[model samples]
Target: MVKQERAARTRRALIQAAAEVFAEVGFVPASLGAISKRAGVSNGALHFHFASKAMLAEAIETEAAETVRRLTEAARARHGDSLQAVVDATHDLMGTLAKDIVVRGGFELAGDIARRTKSPLRKEWQRWIEDSLRRAGHSGELADQVPWADAARVIVAATVGLAVLGVKDATWLSRQNVTRFWELLLPRLTGRRDTGTLVSAGSRPPAAVPAPARSPRTPPAH
Candidate 1:
């Protein structure tokens, strides 16, 4: 039992370390040696956990997918004000993307052609957004003039853009940035009655201003 527990810890350490490296340099340039170094584990330990970098990336992708799945599920289960729940959940995910190396690495690595199919986190996010929008429209949370699918497309595309932009400029994930996006979007998307209750961004003080856009001449990492 002790050995099993130790092995689990080693594998988790390697996955986390690999996520950090992969998030920084992407799948092609990342190396097992670099991941092992970051993990504070020996090469032998890394090999014991994962056969190759591809396997490591798959592991990261799986973990990231699970994280998103839980977030979306919890959002949907909120049971009141579906749109507000969706908005809060999206805000939660942006914060997670800002802070979680595994989640960010999964997104970056999943975009790689060389990587094998793992859990499709991006597609999952898209589905969740569309479904949430549909739920809102059905619940009459959206104005009659708004089309759920069309609005969902705009929001999902914008969110994905933010995730990509955030890779270079973390400010893209900032509360103000997200709030500004919602501030502009909510007016168009939500019913006038629902506007006052929905939170556009996190609870962070609105004073910590967002950063300006930066060129992506350097490889992006979150």
Candidate 2:
């Protein structure tokens, strides 16, 4: 049991280290030795956990997909307006991409021409956007002029482009940048009256809320 627990910890550490290295440098150039060094694990330990760097990258992508899944699910649940939820999901996704090296690495890996396959992260995100837009159109949230297919393309392309750009400059993933994106699109996507209700930026997870203020208690008057 103890061995199993330690193996899990080592595997997690190696994955995180590989993510950091991959996010800094492309996968082709990232070395397993560097990952092991960063992970504070020996070469043998790394090999035991992951046979090769490609295996490590696959693990990173899996973990990143799981995180994105949670983001999509929670955003969908709390949002009464499907379009707004998609918009909010973009905000949350960019925030996660900015802070989580694993997610950033996964996205970068998906874009690698050598990989040849669609990224699970990209596909999952695209699926949610399409589903949400379809729901919005069905429920009359989308504006009369808004085309759901074109809207989905714009949303997916813009966010992917932003995520790619963010690889070089994290500012592209900032709340302000994401807000500007929504600011440009919301007017055309939703009725003007509904625009005021949707959050344009920094909409955190449904569970994220500002903490209440604490003040010193006053002594009771005797």
Candidate 3:
């Protein structure tokens, strides 16, 4: 049991290290030796866990997908009542990617993986975003008259493009700028104005009550 746990830990470290190196240095320039050194693991250990660089790249993609899934799930749980839940979830999802070097690398690696392997991470991300939009009542004909699926695809594509740009040119596509871009885009997509109110999809009332004041109590004599 202990051995299995240690192996799992080592694998995770290797994945994280590889992701960092890939993000810092583009996949074409990255090396397995660098990844092993970053992870503080022997080359043989890394090979044992991941057969080749291609496999390691795939693992990074899988990790990115899993991260997006978890962030979406958390947003759903936290803001279940609001259509903004989808927006909030998307923000959280992007936030995770922006912070993780692995996710950044995965975006760059995706094209190569698609050409070389049958992995469907990009498609999965698009489907997930589309489903979220549908659930948020942003489906069907809006003012723009564009189909929801098409819009969702555009959003995903734009997001991926921005992410790649951000990785390559951090000065041009900083996290703050990316967030503000999304903030502007979301309202337009949902056909809603930024009213700055907590939109609840459920029947629950908003939490508007003020807290009770504390009574003054006599202090004990010192």
Model number with the top lDDT:
2
- Summing lDDT over every window of 10 consecutive residues in candidate 3, give the lowest-scoring window: 213-222
Candidate 3: lDDT of 142? 34
Order of the predicted models by lDDT, top scorer first: 2, 1, 3
Put down candidate 2 lDDT per residue, 107-139, tens digits, no spaces: 988787776766788888888888888888888
Q: Estimate each model's TM-score.
A: 0.84, 0.88, 0.72
Q: Lowest-scoring 10 consecutive residues by lDDT in candidate 1?
A: 213-222
Query: What C-alpha lDDT do the candidate models reach, one value each?
Result: 0.75, 0.79, 0.62
lDDT of 3 by residue, 99-185 (tens): 666676776677553337654556667777787656554533232544566667767777667766766665434445545665666
Summarize candidate 1's per-residue lDDT along 27-137 as a digit string, tens digits: 888888898888777888788778888889888888888788877776666644467666766677787788777788877776666665644788888888888888888
In angstroms, give how far residue 135 of model 3 lies from its true place: 3.2
State which candidate has the highest TM-score.
Answer: 2
Cα error of candidate 1 at position 105, Å? 1.2
Worst 10 residues of 2 by lDDT: 213-222
Q: What is the overall TM-score of model 3 with all chains considered together? A: 0.72
Stretches of candidate 2 above 4 Å error?
Answer: 191-193, 202-222
